[model samples]
Target chain A: MSGIVLPRRQLIARAGGLVAAAGALPLLSGCDAINEAPAVRKILSMGEEMHRASQRALTDRDALAREFTRADLSPVFRPNGTRLPEGEAYAAHAARGFADWRVAVTGLVARPLSLSMADIRAMPQRSQITRHDCVEGWSAIGEWTGVQLSRVLAAAGLKDSARYIVFRCADRIGDADYYESCDLVDALHPQTILAWALNRQLLPIANGAPLRLRIERQLGYKHAKYLSAIEAVASLDGIGAGKGGYWEDRVDYEWYAGI
Target chain B: MTDLPPAMPPVRVYRHRLPTRLWHWLNALTLLVLLMSGLMIFNAHPRLYWGQYGANHDRAWLEIGSTRDAGYLRVGSWKVDTTGVLGRWTDGEGATQRWAFPSWATIPTRYSLADGRRWHLSFAWLLAIALTLYMLWTAFGGHLAKDLHVRRGEWAPRHIWRDIKDHARLRFPAGEAAARYNILQKLSYIGVIFVVLPLMIFTGLAMSPGFNATAPWLIDLFGGRQSARSIHFIAAWALVAFFLVHIAMVLLAGPVNEVRSMITGWFRLPPAKGERA
Candidate 1:
């Protein structure tokens, strides 16, 4: 078309309009489509009530799930997704005990920093015992110790634009890079940690040993292991499929797998 | 010419989107196959309690065979499976049927487990992601709120009574009335989608460790591991029931119309005057 440029004010207005549109998305539904009808409306209302009840059933709003004894561990916590990473760089890191593993924190931050394992451990730490629930219909509980991700993000000095934090991992599930993203609310949750140790020892190779994630509220898949890089973004629209998960992207895993 | 109340026609609008229709039918078929396979797998162990292994007794022929490289543990003496474990010894009645092959040809339970995990896990994603995306799209387009907005007509006592009467006569929504799932389909399908599926996924995950930080509350809420198992089983059965009712309703209302709507995304309803009054 023409080489005319829109005014900067007009551009900002359009962007603001878009954000407002997304925020008010729930209102768009006619309110008579997904949840109402003439026949079973009463029963469905009951279903809605049951859903609210289910929410209340989740207790310990502040108290974290217990950290368990090593004896309470699974016989074999099978490795998920990538047994070993694809890239040569990850292979080298694997060959070594990941002793020199440096996690890069960049994107939408005033201070972009890379921290060593010791640097991470030296920072504030959180230890919790929680059960891991894999989609495979199995459950196991183990103790995890790591740096709380919130502190790291705080250290990086998040810009006003930051909305989501993306974890770029060494593991690859098919062609796309295995990554996970979470909103600021979840990233700042107390239980969410950048775990470096499992069962009182350094992380094991099979179990995302050196460094992994522990987003306690979501499903096992959300607790991405084999951590390498962390990036903060304003929106996930540019990310893979606009879905904020590895399996959620490759297959169709739900991004919100909150129990 | 336009005096007819601006065409405030009695024609009704369907609540379910085309994608939802597709998902419902596809999910039904896959879930049926999955449930069947799940039952067959369950038959292999038939362990009563949750996560607790059952002792191979004389009453049933279910055993969870553990692999032993040490060669010290020998429970039975007979021909082995392909995995080279041991013999297929019967507990009581010598019932030799196992979901897997005999020891000589039988691989360890891990083989079956790992594969089942892959399929179940992957398919669960399809269900979840599709639902999520549809919800997102619907939310943006205001579809969810609109359909769920129950007018006073929907909740009145008379409406309920009329629904009962209609159901008793084996008469259901037809033509444009059926085109829009007369209040009943809207509510039930939403429940199946929003309530049941999420709970199923949550309870399933509550039983796993690799991918989640375990919630003790879930354990307590469901009355421990065994109780969670019971809830999960019951929820699955409820889904199955919903499936049966849904199919029977489709058969009654018109399967060809129902199936075509799902697959082709075009719903054909009989004329309004021809529909049951």
Candidate 2:
């Protein structure tokens, strides 16, 4: 009992020291030099990895994103990030009703294919009412109709080495075209689609007209609107900023935004 | 002088336990991070709604926004020009920024939804796991039944009313009476631990898309995802209020002794009236 009573003082002191260390981290992180430290970055990355691994452990690999009834659809589905793509190429495609636009699926595939809008629409299509969860703390339910991306990947005969799918979009934010990528696990999800229609109508200009990748399990940013091309790659090393997505590269958004 | 009667000092009692102290401090840090990061995340939308869905065109129950001339905060039918405080304010750099919650109250101190989310989700795991472990430890370790649970005699309305009256007068129990928590303290602890914390954790998980895939019924339980978000915001504010009241009570009771008790698990119990120190 005497030993237990004496140790309390030491316990308090040790706890105080640990708390002080944790408190100092934000102060040090505020400085550019300290924030850029490999150890600090590694710790931050480790937190994200832990979260991703734990969430993955909880759910099945092919678990579906929740589907809702038509009555659950929002009165107006809000468009996030860049509303429209600018440039002559996108304008030319839009002007011709995207008739000339083709989604080029190349790199590490047995048969590289340039699929026209007509060709994509002619494929067996699926329509579902799913909630679009924005990373910015809002959600809206909308109906989407499209061909499963896995079907397209199968049609192109993805090479066994294809580990990730990179989406190169026509939308430009700053100097670079907005781009995003996902692991093959997400790519092959049953509900992941290259949606050409919303609410039984042609996709609106403000809502990724012509085509948008609706990877339902992730946040709105991962959906990658105004899609121009798809590339199958074994690694994300050489992609734009190389963190798997535009926001992930520029703003340190986690690549695996399952939540 | 050596033969004179000796003076008695205040009695020291072991009040809080070590695990409780550890849990309290950890919760303090986690809650602070969660609240600040949550506020920053809220700044992204600046609106709250009821039912299943809401957007720019749809009506919202609450909104914080700014126009060219002034800022406004609206809740239900009531609206206030909260300019220069809530909806719009100047930051450390003297640049005007529009936000629902000011820069001082948010993580990053600047607009970055991505960073805000990263902090919020990371600390959420800490809060959830810690609370779970703490609850389990308190229950199985006999702390709950021994200290937190109100006694049969104390449950009487007269006794409860007396405790309330004493608290209203800032008259905390002393000496032998102070060895255990008062009925009021136990009740508030129960409210925060079992009610508020669980609500916060559940509503938070309800808002996550990935979690929704696993448990869509949670969203339905809260009426909708937006409803869950609204409830989360409200509960966070409730927690903040609870924290403020907790700190105020600590100060009122005698800061040094109260704080030391929480920190070191040893408390100098206040003497009863006409009793020797």
Candidate 3:
């Protein structure tokens, strides 16, 4: 009886191992297939929308991200993604301290304006020390000083038809220049700024020098750096892959990255 | 003496309600997806730190990384080589992939933070909503008082000690006694339901930048965002441990009977020892 029971148990265990191995192969591929399915992807994306709507509903529109004092600042703010833009065009601007660089405000605006570095500096500047959260789950605190994006949008006179503000960058990733967008809620948020300085010094080239968007409430990717243009549009259609931002188009990152 | 009457057939009794059974399965699926996808997300930055802010330049309390020929997990001053399992492992193609967790353990079966976040965040809604409903039902629907509530005497140290000893010895109760949860079972269920699950949800929310703005008090509650993240990771493992022990207990008590109780709400009681047919 012992002999029979022991052999059967061993056989069952071996069969179980074989079954698991066979099952796992298909299971892994099945997961990938489900992930790649357009219907499944669309349903998953609804979670992002749900998060955005729920957050908006729960909090005041003007609620602020926590601000840190100077003492709480990270000693060195680590730079991520396109530390420096490529090409002789960016090198020439950087070599001359970006004096000739201009950020053009165009599209769906009452007045299109090409403002240089000096023009930006003359505008009322707002400085903030805020946490920069990366999508990879790390964070760094730094001081950013620049003109409020609301002030710039107001000066340019945003057309009533405008629904999204798209930022074009000097950095070319892959075949296209990096770009990002946000709706009026974040575009006109007082904390949103086109920062030109970091940690009480001129922003380093590694950290989007000369100009960058500081959408304090969003993740690092939403803060487009190496600014070249700011376009306000009635719709995000016809943009790169019709997504609001570069990563959103390329890797399916959530357009609204407030999470 | 006259021969004893034939032993009575084992009693088949109702052991679980519909809501309990439904939630049990739903939670099982939700937790598995959350854990797998979460591991994929962790692969993005396989390090844990404390305080309000931490990044590449800041020191990490725990990290999983690979060197030239070896994989390691470092917890503060201590380090262990986890080669061929964690930090570094071979994929199905026999290619040596260096990631914090192996491919089989992640949701996509490949490294894709974007896909991982989508899976994690999507199922996170299921976890949160189900847990809320389950808790509400448990509290107001008499499941708590009827099934899980500790009676007067069960609170005594001796009573708890006896339960622990019985569990350690695999002396699970038989007959009518087996129908109810013992003290140890009651405590663990209460802990997981009331404490651990809520902590997972809150710490998860605390990591969200948007949620941080909405409720900065959450950060303060957990000491900091990074701290919340660390606690979240630790609680995930705690849930895994609880799952393992829970499975073992089921198998020990009687897999067929236990599983049927959860699935079909019917359990066949084991006869008490020394009973004769």
DockQ of each: 0.04, 0.28, 0.36
Please give, for residues A1-259, the per-residue lDDT of candidate 1 as tens digits: 0001112322433453343345333332222122123343343233323422443354333445445566656554545545566778877877787778999999999999899888999998888776665443344567789999989998999889999999988776545667888777678879889998887788887677578888866556777778889999999887887877766554334455453
lDDT of 3 at B71: 88
lDDT, model 1, position B27:
74
Q: What is candidate 2's lDDT per residue for A1-259, written digit by digit as tens?
A: 0000111222433453443355434452243233234575566677678767877887777878888898888878887777768888888888999999889999999999999999999999999999887777677889999999999999999999999999988888766788989888889988999999999999998889899999888878889888889999999997987898877776677888777
lDDT (Cα, tens digit) per residue for candidate 3, span B1-277: 3677777888888989999999999999999999999999898889999999898889999999999888899999999999998898888768898899998899877677888889999999999999999999999999899999999999999999999999999999987888888899989999999999999999999998888887999989998989999999999999999999999999999999999899999988888776536
Kindly indicate the candidate among 1 and 2 with the higher lDDT: 2
**Residues A99-203, model 3: lDDT tens digits:** 999999999999999999999999999999999988888989999999999999999999999999999999987577889999998999989999999998999
Q: Candidate 2: where is the Cα deviation over 4 Å?
A: A1-38, B1-6
Candidate that would win on lDDT: 3
Ranking by DockQ: 3, 2, 1
Instruction: Identify the superior model by lDDT, candidate 1 or candidate 3.
Output: 3
lDDT of 1 by residue, B1-277 (tens): 5543343334434545766676667777557534543443343333323441112222112223434331111223432342322223321224443333232221111113322333344455556666677667656756666665456688887887887788778787655565555566667867877788777776655553311233566665555443465466568778889988887887887788767767666666654553333
Candidate 3 deviant stretches above 4 angstroms: A1-24
The per-model lDDT (C-alpha) reads 0.58, 0.82, 0.88
Give model 1's docking category.
Answer: incorrect
Q: lDDT rank, highest first?
A: 3, 2, 1
How large a fraction of the reference contact set does each model reproduce? 0.06, 0.52, 0.72
Q: List RMSD in Å for every model shown.
A: 17.5, 8.8, 8.4
